[model samples]
Target chain A: MKQSVYDLTQQHRSIRQFKDEPLSKETVQKLVEAGQMASTSSYVQAYSIIGVTDPDIKQALKEVSGQQHVVDNGYLFVYVIDYYRHSLINNETKGNMETSFESAEGLLVGTIDVALAAQNVALTAEDMGLGIVYLGSLRNDVERVGEILGLPEHVFPLFGMAVGVPSDDEQGSPKQRLPFEHVFHENQYNSDKTQQLEQIKQYDKEIQDYYQKRTNGKRSESWSEQIRKMMSKKTRPDILENLNVKGFMKK
Target chain B: MKQSVYDLTQQHRSIRQFKDEPLSKETVQKLVEAGQMASTSSYVQAYSIIGVTDPDIKQALKEVSGQQHVVDNGYLFVYVIDYYRHSLINNETKGNMETSFESAEGLLVGTIDVALAAQNVALTAEDMGLGIVYLGSLRNDVERVGEILGLPEHVFPLFGMAVGVPSDDEQGSPKQRLPFEHVFHENQYNSDKTQQLEQIKQYDKEIQDYYQKRTNGKRSESWSEQIRKMMSKKTRPDILENLNVKGFMKK
Candidate 1:
């Protein structure tokens, strides 16, 4: 049976373009309320979301994010991995609460908490027939984003999500995934699991063919070639020292 | 108008006690399939999930997590923040993908990507009438968990989600939340938004009352007080430096 959950799963795709329209206040409220309804950790609810609506601010964010369509197209949400609220609460209660970055574990909890909440909001928006894109580029200059959001110490912007009704030609196919066998392991992780190599090669061919078809066979390169080009040109942010400065240890 | 998303949101809660019944193979398949359907970064899909079924192993994890219900519960899933697939793909293509501590962006992407997927599984599980509790405590001993799962470098254990049908007594009330004003911000963040301090204080009182009513005031304390006690203890894992060893740089 084609289950409803699987149906929802099949419906997900990253949307980069949107119709020129603004999101309603009611829609924003519903999205955030549904997000708050997400499963939070220890009821600490250690995450904060900022909704950006001012076109001037959106234009600035678009520049910061390399002119991504989502930044300027519709509703942009900056999800912050926040422990600042707990710190505030701690201050109120005296020397009770603390934000210690002794290990990667602390950072992991905050990141995951924000991720879960954001996904819930994304799904709820999609259920409302809106398209969405997650702005990983927000990290390109997270400090800028933090400043824009007026974030305090212990609250780092994990990333942003942009949501809106899709323009007609904005549909994109599901990006091919490594087979479930490659990603999922049974009892112990099997690194030697290359039984799908040949299948993946076929997938590489399929990807190249799809790109060619998209460009009328003008650009024909395998997935490996594309990855090589992308990897060779390092575009990652200088966030290592930034996290340390913001209070997370590499430990 | 009441939104269906509201109903779905209200359905989320942490379920600790579960019947000894095992989840069918079909159930696990459906859950993981839903997870795989989550939106990923650049379609890199940088995450993997491992399902634990062996009772002995489950018991061991339960001990590690310091939660009795871990072994006695339904399906326990360890959502892993993984960049190993990209590394392998890099190897195959001889793509010069950097695997340095400076890959803070990759780690964040992996952690956030997997977390988004895990949250989907939680929601899908709930839709199937199941309950879930995210166990952040699993990070208390990263080395042990890594050993148990045979995790490779670049694949860090993010969090655990214990999923199953809830036993009647296990139903906990919605944990009191900070007011909407405290958590949500408009175009820009208001850092000194202590205007909501009164609301937070009210929540603290509500949580203390909840604990007292449930425990006959045996462990009466405000939310802030409980958080203080939790932060007072230095019981986190010793795997912070290990991230650097695993190729993550704190800067």
Candidate 2:
């Protein structure tokens, strides 16, 4: 037995590189079932998944995902947080009744439902001895991705997953995270000032050291440096506008 | 050893009723680590979790969660989708940057990051041989929940997880989902018009059957009836407006 879910969970990490082996249709069906088994909002199941296997389509997605392996290596799935189904039903019954602030709650539920389903897919892939990487970068160009996938209004791609066998070129290393004291509060939310700073500083050093080791002492940057670089920049795939276009009011 | 991740995944079902058994601190720590191991956006890790063990606090949360059993059962975790830490760093650096929608992309990444981390927490909890339920009803009163959690700006509670040894109050049955063809698309998104109605009809029967088995024939409703009840209604969560008051323009 795995003893604890932690054992399976502690094993989670993003795999960017992958082996060329392909996932069978049977395995893919299993993956989809795992996702469906995940908890849904009020059992509404407010999400849908699109699996891409065609080489040409996968290549197009690979470009969108910044050439991530799962798109090219084995199985690629785009998880869409959707309200379209509800909207269809609402139109039939209420004649365009807006959901007000509670409707915003529906958006969150959809997002959460997609997240839960995606997690199950990722973990189940791991359990099947497959390497997987989530392509958050897919949000970099949602319109193109939506067009490519033929996603209709009220359906937005939350993220993509590339899953396959791990290749020799792939080296899986656990990423450093901010400490427990910082991330996990007690009954109440606590910001342990000193502990947080000290732990972060230590974690920064560890990340820098890890990078140097991985790169044979070629590249190195502190966690703060990385954050500064990443935050001080901007990216594309205007998500808010897309959500609005998809019928969500950020208002 | 597990034969396939799919085999293990099929065992997943949200368990709300618990056995009144408590979890150890070490176990909780391990579960949190599993969550931490989940991928973060640009490695920002823009989320925090609060483990509620105090009976009083859990009781208040139980009410927020529509009196869900898991909320008061054993361990309750409020996953806060946060940007406060980023805001703090921005202020410290005099960066004058906001985690809000400078572009639509920012909002998507932040919210998606939060969702992904929370999903990891739920899965890990289940893997631990413990039962867990996601409390989407927490949105019923986000501000009150925030007040209870003492959440600062940019640290909003997204959803909650209640985990522990499951009790026999009610055994959960796998609810029927729209058939895979209805949800999963191939290379191009296919709206299978002909198959949709038949599949839904089958699903309505499946859901009705599931309710009959789970509730001992007490109550039943078709898919459309449930949708009419849930989707064709008006709901609002004022706490969401507070996001703007706190300086997050989700727009």
* Best model number under TM-score: 2
| TM (chain A), candidate 1 | 0.88
Error of 1 at A51 (Å): 0.9
Docking quality level of the chain pair in candidate 1: medium
lDDT of 2 by residue, B38-72 (tens): 77877878788898988788878877777657354
Interface RMSD of each: 3.4, 2.7
Worst 10 residues of 2 chain A by lDDT: A95-104
- Model 1 misplaced stretches (Cα beyond 4 Å): A1-3, A93-103, A193-202, A209-216, A219-221, B1-3, B93-95, B99-102, B213-219
State each model's CA lDDT, in order.
0.74, 0.73
Cα lDDT tens digits for candidate 2, A7-57: 666766777767778899998988899888888877778888998888888
Model 2 fnat? 0.60
Listed in order, each prediction's TM-score against the native is 0.91, 0.92
CAPRI quality of model 2: medium
